[model samples]
Target: MLEPLGVDATCELVYREMLTHPGEGVAALAQRLGLSREDVGIALDQLSSLALVRQSYEPSGRQRPVSPEVAMRILLERQSAELEAHQHRLALSRAAATQLIAEASEAMADPQQVGVELLVGIDRIREWLSQLATEIQGEVLTFAPDGAQTQDNMDASRPLNLGLLQRGVRLRTIYLESIRSDAPTLDHVRSLIRSGAEVRTAPLLPTRMIIADRRLAMLPVDDHDSGRGAVVFSESPTVQALHALFESVWERARVVGGAPPSSKDADLAPQDAAALKLLAEGHTVESIAKRLGVSPRTARRITTSLQDRLGARGRFEAGVKAVRRGWLPMRD
Candidate 1:
């Protein structure tokens, strides 16, 4: 029990023995406790460091063990202080994260002198992506919101991805949770995981993105049709902002093929939670289906199921009840 208070078993045993046999020296205590003299000495050293033992008034070098009451009080005070410091640091970090996110949002809404280059058409985008992939030295973060990927897309990406992995580049990708039901996409994800890539899935994503070396970010000009064009941000507020967005989503996303998040969104499945969010946002069935990469029938099924679970008469009531039940996040 005292282990939680930072006292090891040996130290605790020695401390108890010392309390019982106050007049006994280290040798006597060691013999009684069945511990070697060296072990006893080490335990005493640990106790002294913890202030559970103090110098005895006796001329002999033997140390006197502090009373249990005083020792425990000291330990509790130390623990409290450490916890306070930890919380303070966490608060500071939270504030900094909030500031970064706010700045990133503003930057996206109205870009500043942020170094940016717009590449129109699939050919230009692919050319720049290839060039950037070769230049990357550290890591790549990607948000694949396009739902299910085509066989050709997967095949074309393999060589570049494998080359980066061989060069010891860390790659992390977040795909839509809907892809779990798609065999081809799942197989491609598994292959990437086998090659030392980390993959996760989220219910919804804001856009398709790729950030390389924390210095450049690539975003699709149009989410529905990426072939239209792309925007490449280089070492600017916009890139930093996109990185922040990736990190925020990554934290809430679930690991592919792993167990669902425990107790989050009141234990609702990721897809269920996503559906509720979209419903609350007043998205039509068609729009929700497109966003979730599911067919209209499946989207309707999920929506109907949500309404039934919430005992709601319609989509409006379902959204209201979902918010009241804490099953979905509140949006402004």
Candidate 2:
């Protein structure tokens, strides 16, 4: 425990030996502790600096151990004062950083220069997103395509999303309907909703995009291969168009928790509905099974059930009938 106060084991041993053999010289203490004379001399220097040991004029200028109670109190007081001073400096640094960031953002806000930056690799995208989330001033709009998010993705996103929410930034998100039955993703969505975010689901989404404060937007450079890289758009017109596309889709999407179950959709469970929506999106039975975490046989059975319920001949007709009956919300 004394190590935290810069007291090493050797120093403690030397001090203990000095305590028992009061007014002992460093050589005598070294012999009692079975340590080298050089080691004992170093320990003596440290203990003296900490006021844990001192050279006594009596007894031929030998060393004497100070009372630990007094020594420890002085060390703690010094530590506390240093900690407070460091904290004060840290706060000032943070304030300066915030001002510098604001100035940099302003400098980069030129309309003539298209702020289209290419971020290569997932690591770069994640890093940029983290920094962008912290600087978001008004709102964050996201179009999350694909199926249910992986646990790793959700874990990575939680801190950034929650930080933005805590800062009073409005969060509006649109997710693919296929993820509606995803337990982990659904749980994460519910938590965000509780934190004042508006979340919705649709049968299909155009692409994965994130727009922050209506000023900047980011989308994968190649939608088919997101790992390739992503493009960041700061041009006002392009960002506005992306924002509009999100709003249009958001208008038609069903609210995750607030939308009341339609009487037509009530006949099917949430997972069943999600499966049907995925099927309607041209997803194969194997892919559907994978997304739903079920067997291929179970996925085929679900399709059969939808076909029977809609009185359709096949998968395509079933999809058409489901759309007509308003049982599934399909993106045009």
Tell me the TM-score of each prediction against the true structure.
0.64, 0.54
lDDT of each: 0.82, 0.77
Residue-level lDDT tens digits of model 2 in 190-282: 999998899998765767899998999998765657787787888578899998999998997889876666786578766577788776655
Query: In every candidate, how many clashes are there?
Result: 0, 0
| Alpha carbon RMSD to native, model 2 | 25.0
Give the alpha carbon lDDT tens digit for every residue of 40-147 in model 1: 999999999999999888878679888889996787665545444654665688679768755654454454545766677888887887887789999999998867
Candidate 2 TM-score versus the reference: 0.54
40 Cα displacement, candidate 1 (Å): 71
lDDT of 2: 0.77
List candidate 2 stretches off by more than 4 Å. 1-113, 264-283, 286-299, 310-332
